[model samples]
Target: MNAHTKGKARSTRVKEGMTVKVVRGQHKGKQAKVSEVNTKKSTVYLEGIEATRRDGQKAPIPIHTSNLFVEAQK
Candidate 1:
């Protein structure tokens, strides 16, 4: 179980518009401004972190906060 299971992630220090870096996962080391925060799922959407969909549209992935580190606030 992860921190989300314990519901501690709902109180994450990271907030929307903050600068963050991916500390883990395939996106590791990528830093960007936070676009949104989904406390319900403990995920954060970053401005520069996205994947190109098959339809040729770019979409932001919902990364768990556990894989992110707040670099600064925007």
Candidate 2:
């Protein structure tokens, strides 16, 4: 990140379709394509990587950028 005069943080450049793998949590080693990226929330949704909701439906869990390692570019 470049120095900012106003001290505003830089937004992540991650985009959809990039392949990434979880590296620091229980989901570690799991790899998938990035389905969505919420830069405002600093989270990412991975394709086929989801958690079961209370209603029995699969929901995409928000994985923080710090936990992911990009394997392929978009």
Give per-residue CA lDDT, model 1, range 1-74, as digits (tens): 88888876544488888888899999999999989889899899999789999999999999999998877766
Provide the overall lDDT of each model, using Cα atoms, as 2-decimal numbers: 0.87, 0.86
Candidate 2, lDDT over the whole model: 0.86
- Cα lDDT for residue 18, model 2? 91
Candidate 2 residue-wise lDDT, 1-74, digit = tens:
55586686444477899989899887899999999889899999998888998999999989999998878787
The CA lDDT at 2 in model 1 is: 88
Best candidate according to lDDT? 1
TM-score, every prediction: 0.79, 0.79
Note the residue pairs that clash in candidate 1.
Answer: none
* Least accurate 10 contiguous residues by lDDT in model 1: 4-13
